[model samples]
Target: MKSNLLSLEMMNGQERLHEALEMRGFLVKKEGPFLMLASGSSKRDLRSLKMLLNKLHIPIFWNGDRFQLLTNKFPVMMMKKITEHRGEEFPVSMEGYHFRWRAFVNRKNGLKVDALDLDPHIACFVKAVNEAGIPCLAGCDGHLKHAPNLQFSGVYSGAWFQIIQEQYLSEFELNYTWNVEFKGGSGSRLVASKARNERWDRHKIYEDTLKMAYKLKEHADEIKKRKASSFKRNAGMKEEAEGLRTDGRFEELVDWMERLSN
Candidate 1:
């Protein structure tokens, strides 16, 4: 194993992470949620692959139009000095991405159970980027091969507004932590323990979240319509039961219910 590159054994949720490597014909091993990939000559290839995943560009339907964001659906950008990345006011620039606002939460560290500040700063950052007519992209730290880091960030950012629909208007909770239990692995904890005391304006974060929701209201309504239609189709399965209850044959109805249960 190259000391410069990350070890796959240290990665959390490798079973799911295996899919990405498998797609490229890399042999992998799974022990619970952790994974191990063959190293040596393939190591450089692995790192390069992850780099590509970190900057994936994909399209999403937003407000009746298609929008492209960086690196697949979720952009996973990691910060070296996350707290400093935010400005005294609005729009903190971390690396090259400008965050209009940031939020922090106190949560138990997935690695050692120590409390840490879980910052989903990217959540509101992406929202602001999209609102400003900029192509939003999720970013990664370019280190570990964890699933939530590699995969869920992409998936979460893709449906961020929908996942936190009602709560979008509420106080920004820094409580978002990706937790998946493993037999011997720490839950792919992303936060460092030193930054638990970072301060943020909850109200301002809430306002940015609301802005994100308002911008995507049309898309949310469309999603609701599709869900309702799906429920209506599934409700058809109860049509026979409703008919039986309406008819006067009580014993026959009981028999039909028994048959359906079986």
Candidate 2:
């Protein structure tokens, strides 16, 4: 499968590589330098393709149908740093907050040497969502006169915001109301407004946004644990299946294979 999937010669150009992907039953589209695979592709097929590519030292980002071959220009090290710093405590000072904010933004938008002139209050939330693997596009602290908001890209952004709303923000909803505004293909915005007639306080908004960041980290960690566990289980099942085939236990192997499929 690996040999037939792609050859070293095919990697010479995007046009040739995309043709190979289409022949292998992938519905492919080219968006700038990114190759977008249609969501209709099976998960197992996508996983197998990703594994093969990784073994060849090619990096690919597979998020549902949005598969893209990451170029050398991609901020791989910065992204690793963001993931590594996921467990760090919220920034206590303005400088610390800017540092975290710059890391997250640069990971998504490439390097930005200039200081990020964003509101310090919104920095923690920006860092949180981006590090959680949800691409945050824009954010504002709303000062003391307006509602604080964060914008995220892609269709899944709305679903991610829903999870944070239903599971993480339940307790905070009493004092501060949150809502998601979907902009069709433009992505979604998560806005935080005051509950009832209570006026917006900048300090409370900053504190609440920090709490939301913590909850986002907790959610991201849970996802990582589940993925790790699933990978181990699948690996063990594959080893058992291979052993069963080698030992000529056809009937037992069939049963084991069925279990593994489930």
Candidate 3:
């Protein structure tokens, strides 16, 4: 593994430090109040960078987004000295295509867990599914060499099945085609189909997948709204029945009770 320690030592400011780290294959970005670092695709680089940070006495912690430098751990003067330099802030938009972070709650202990950064292409889809109340178990962007896919849990419900079927059949002929495979009790997988040996159109797939994600979210929201409306109507009827009973209107109470049963 290559080390950026020597070059970092020679760096006078944050700009220089950022450049040195980048040259050593680390992705450096500003996230909120902290500087964040990622190793991109290299485990060796990540290990080397972690070692260098430890040697420098910089406290870092993984915060779902990236390894964030704990600037507060240092004295104010020392922190200012080390972090004083400015350059263009890292782009916050998807144009940069950095991996996305997600936080999951551990069911066993109910503790918040940080998930590994997701591939940029499929991250939004995963987020959409999750926000729509379906659990996304895994996803792959296919690295442009195969079909990108997402694995989901609890997709056997009638509503989800219908939505998946509609999307799968409707998007079949598109450049970024979609397929849904049901695994019975195991849940379902949504695949962005690509022919063997055909490189995926990453940008196209990203755009198409996002559209599909929006559609799924819309359907999920509609279902939730319908359920809520049904529940509210039922509760209102029950309240009306109780009011009728309390008012000694036996005929009205019976009619309300019969309506509720039906």
Candidate 4:
């Protein structure tokens, strides 16, 4: 019988990654719960992703743009041995235990991304791909305890190519088609909200801090009354008041209060 081993040929990093995912039975065509669903994601999570991927925004109108909008439907499964086939090396620990799991979402729209819903097994391998920013590793087992990328230790860097090519040559279908005129605002609103927040953050030092100080003072006064009643201070109240007194910018405010006290 012929051995089933993945071979590395002439494919770039991204292409390799796509292929490796296929070999492990995670191509877009494979219909499982791990596919992207249009209705599953919440408005809040979408808004956050839109803000985070703001600079990385690609439009359906853009010629090379892949995913304009997408929502992960289900989590991917993780297992030590997906099948009983041989001739391939599966990830194993020194104790001969397999490191496997359902760690994350396998489906992405134009491009694959990671947030919270990833399966732990899928998350380990997928996170490595995202962090490497390329199709450098195919799959990961346990928390790698190696050097700089110890967490990614014992990762199958070549498996990426194996699966990606397999998916492309095999039958894979895109979940949905993006419209050239598709401008319904999955993320644009979030970007605008973020811009407003940046403006708020810019002036927050003087205005926001003063507002916080006012709130703290109200609590501080209650503490003073408590202290008068019982010759001891509330630790929480003392800490808050002292924070305003000793901190750099607050020091100036504290000095102003001392002059008023005098």
Candidate 5:
């Protein structure tokens, strides 16, 4: 086992990940339902993956997409300067697939009685034990096999977004950690968390979100358009309105224009 772990560390990052998955019982082929990649488990990786997911167009409520993320998501990447504090978790990252099938499924976040943050390697074994991600952490007290160094845990909040069974497969050969999950998620993400939140007007919320993002991209254009226009026509715009409404100064000018038009 020590030799295997050493060889894994010696392998390039991607190879280490694939090897780990295979060791855990998954058979990796050149052509499979998914292709996996690995990267730094650093703060940069965490932030980037978070953004990717936040902007991803996949619909989580659907079974097919849920299957995709839960199974194929990459390990969570967070860094702690202190070796003891440093731990990792996983999040699904599916592309070219759809988990609409998840719409037919119903699941909840792991009972969060006492959520925890532990080593990534140990977390995989926990996943192995529960046969589901319903438990936030699996103890590293040698209760599980193949991971002696396993003494920590953490979770993916998005785990509850959707859960699918088909895309969820395992090759458990005595507890090795995989770098990523597989066979999950169809891309082209649209925000669905909004719909999940009680305070949100999902449709209107996301519409405005998208509008704001688009508006940010065309900042210069909005500025030029507002400057060139003689008549301001944005008086009654909804407060929720996003985008560069008549250049970047739309809000500042709205009151004056509203008074004039009235």
Candidate 6:
């Protein structure tokens, strides 16, 4: 029973990741959702591999990636002990958890950032494991800008990897692909849109925001005159207003507006 007989099921949006690994000489066998890695694959420096994958915008499947590193015997025994497997490590819902959005400034660079609320379940699990004398630790998953770095508290240096500077398509670029789809009984017409300079789009967005702000101000006045409505309407209005106010380039937009007024 060598550890090489491990199988990991790759989820959706992970095909490119699998291909990337294979291209790198990893002995990976894709059998449906499961990916079987050769022996000694896990013992290698996984963080380095994760760092490369992060540059490609592919994250390891929640717990599946970590669990594959364990010996088959140990994983099997743990699975039997837990009995309630499947959804324990990750949420079962196809849809993601509805985490509350937050806005704050990054302490390191003083840049305004948006993030989601922390998962309480993770804390509870860590406490439970520690109380059971399992010596469990909590750390970052090293996704995207974060390195695949994981360390114990005693020896942890909370350093993140430098952002990889490469000409790659981001989520914003992918938005143009949404209108690109195959028609029924017709050959797919894959048309790549002409790339425009980002500055052009940024200028347009700033102008649109100024126009929207005026419209929202008018709507806010109208709402005041109307009868009281549900909290949903109020919350929607508040969120949009806050988003515009907190935009990182908002100060520059204000200057543009002032110049236009002159």
User: Top model by TM-score, which number?
Assistant: 2
If both were scored by TM-score, which would come out higher, candidate 5 or candidate 6? 5
Inter-residue clash pairs, candidate 2: none
Best by lDDT: 2
Task: Find the number of clashing residue pairs for candidate 5.
Answer: 38
Q: Write model 5 residue lDDT over 1-262, tens digit each, in one string.
A: 3223355335443344343332221222232433232221223433332333345432222232211233323232311111122233434333221222122122222222111233322322332222232222222322222213211121111221112111122222212222212111221111222122234332232223223222222242332232224222243432212232223333333343333323
TM-score of each: 0.18, 0.40, 0.39, 0.17, 0.21, 0.19
Error of 2 at 157 (Å): 1.1
The better-scoring model by lDDT among 1 and 5 is: 1
208-240, model 6: which lDDT tens digit per residue?
A: 222322232224323222212211224554464
Runs of candidate 2 exceeding 4 Å displacement:
1-115, 171-174, 195-197, 224-262
- For candidate 4, lDDT tens digit of each residue in 26-108? 32211232222122222443443333335333111212322222331211221122210122222322211111111111111
Full candidate order by TM-score, most accurate first: 2, 3, 5, 6, 1, 4
Q: What does the lDDT come to for candidate 4?
A: 0.25
For model 2, the run of ten residues with the poorest summed lDDT: 108-117
**Tens digit of per-residue lDDT, candidate 2, span 36-152:** 644333345455456545655656676665566556333333332222221212222122222222232223221111012335566556655655555565567776678888666
Q: What TM-score does model 6 achieve against the real structure?
A: 0.19
Model 1 / residue 225 / CA error / Å: 1.1
Candidate 1, after superposition: displacement of residue 217 in Å? 1.9
Q: Give the TM-score of candidate 3.
A: 0.39
Q: What residue runs in model 4 are displaced by over 4 Å at the alpha carbon?
A: 1-37, 42-44, 60-114, 117-121, 124-142, 146-262
Candidate models: Cα lDDT each: 0.28, 0.49, 0.45, 0.25, 0.26, 0.25
- Ordered by lDDT, highest first, the candidates read 2, 3, 1, 5, 6, 4
Candidate 3 per-residue lDDT, tens place, 1-262, comes to: 0122344345444444444343222345566744565322234435545666676676567655456544423343443323221212121221111110111111111111111244555654554454444445556677777778766542222224335445433753456666656442324567766667677786677566556555554565554333233223344554664465345454454344334323
Off by over 4 Å in 6: 1-13, 31-36, 66-262
